[model samples]
Target: MSGLLALLDDVAAIAKVAAASVDDIAAAAAKAGTKAAGVVIDDAAVTPKYVHGFQADRELPIIWRIALGSLKNKLVVLLPGLLALDAFAPWAITPLLMLGGAYLCFEGAEKLVHMFAPHADHEIEADFDTRDPARLEEEKVAGAIKTDFILSAEIMTIALATIESPSFWMQAITLAVVGTFITVAVYGAVALIVKMDDLGLHMAATGHTSGSRALGRGLVRAMPRLMAVLSTVGTAAMLWVGGNIVIHGLDVTQLWAWPYKTIKYVATELANALPAAQGLVQWLVTAALDGVFGLILGVILIPIATRVVGPAIAAIWPGKST
Candidate 1:
């Protein structure tokens, strides 16, 4: 009887330790995930567009496919690469992060330019090929997956950097958790956003109450505006996050400190002035400055990317430039 009681005590202790480890992983993942909010938001914002022009019935299936691709991106490809980096060349992480940041900035700035640029019929026509529906879907999914790979790389790198754990296994577990959680959260939101109109239509058609019908109508009306807002927010987030990464990378390299310090100083001043909203003021000031820096860097890179890099890639890859 005493032996049986001792075995039970040992089992109980082991279970407690397992539970504690699980909690630690959860906490670490949540913290790490928070650090990549900008990319995550942009991911959620950007994914819905791939479903555009597809049949309504295909939207969820397409999103599911993309989500699975995203999962594979994080788990199969990026996770192992990141672990290798962590094990062998941890120093490379920051530079890789900065590169990803520059990419985000460039992408955001390019979109901004296109938004304001005079419309060109050729550009529209170029994209309006009479491809088969299935082929077009495949192409769209492929493009989205490729884009997701870049964003996921940034997210995982950011999360890896934010993790405080010194244990290799702990870091791995935390990263896995962060990756899975983020993929699900992002694609789940995309699915919801894309289907919202349909949901609203159904609600409008079936609602017995006037208020429900009104709310349904409101959702339908609001979706376009909501999508626009999301796009704008996503652009801003890319700039802010990208700029932050570049500045921090520079700081890490001991190459530049003035930009970061100056931003901080100004934000501090604003915080002091608006004591009631100190945190908000500081955050806004910092984000604005970061975004400005990102915009400038992106603008500079735009010509180089389009004129130099684009042609170079086209030359190398022939017809596979995209």
Candidate 2:
């Protein structure tokens, strides 16, 4: 009887420790996820464009495909890749981050060019107009997943940095929890945002109350404009975030400090100018400067990417340049 009671005590103690570990993981994940909120927002903002022109019925399916790809990017690819990188070549993280940032800048600038010069369509846009629907959808999903991989890398890295130096298993668990929670939160929000128009249509059609129907009609009318605005915001966000990442990476790598320092100095001066709204002014100035730099870098890289890199990839991997 005494031995059984002792064994029961040991089991109870083990259960308590397990419960505590779960609580710790949850808290750590939340904190780490919060630190990556900017990238999370950018991820959500950037995704809607991938589903922009699809049929109403196809919209949710497209989003689901992209969401699944995003989950794979984070959990299957990034989680393991980042963990290995963190364990082995910690110094390489910043440069790789800068590479991802440059890609975002390139994508954002490409969109800007398309906006300004509709005659000069990108390969993807051309494919969309000319190719089979299935092919276009495949390309769109692939592109979205590629972009998500970059952003997810940043998010996971940020989360890893935010978490304190716990045990190896603890760190891994926290990162996994953070990655899963963020993936669900971000894509879930994206799903809702994309389906909003459909919801509005349903409400407009079926609502018994006149006010509810009227509100639904307003929602339906507003969706197109909202989507357009969201696309523009997404583009700007890509630039802002991409530039910010590169600048910080440059600072971290000790390659160039001037851009980050100059931006801070200028933002501080502007904040002083508008002391009443100093925080807001500072943030705006910093973001504007980052975006401008991102655009410049992207524009510079465009020709190099198109003329040199694209051809190199095409030569190596036949159908991939498009």
lDDT by residue for model 2 over 1-322, one digit each (tens)? 9999999999999999999999988899889999999889988899998898888888889888888888788888887887788889988889999999999899899889979986784565676663477888888889888888888989999998998855778888998898888888888888888888888888899999998898889888998898898899889988998899999998888899999999999999999999999999998999999999999999998888888898899999988872
- Highest TM-score scorer: 2
Best-performing candidate as measured by lDDT: 2
TM-score of each predicted structure versus truth: 0.88, 0.96
User: Residue pairs in steric clash, candidate 2?
Assistant: none
Clashing residue pair totals per candidate (backbone < 3 A): 0, 0
Which residue runs of candidate 1 sit more than 4 Å off their true CA positions? 1-13, 118-140
Worst 10 residues of 2 by lDDT: 121-130
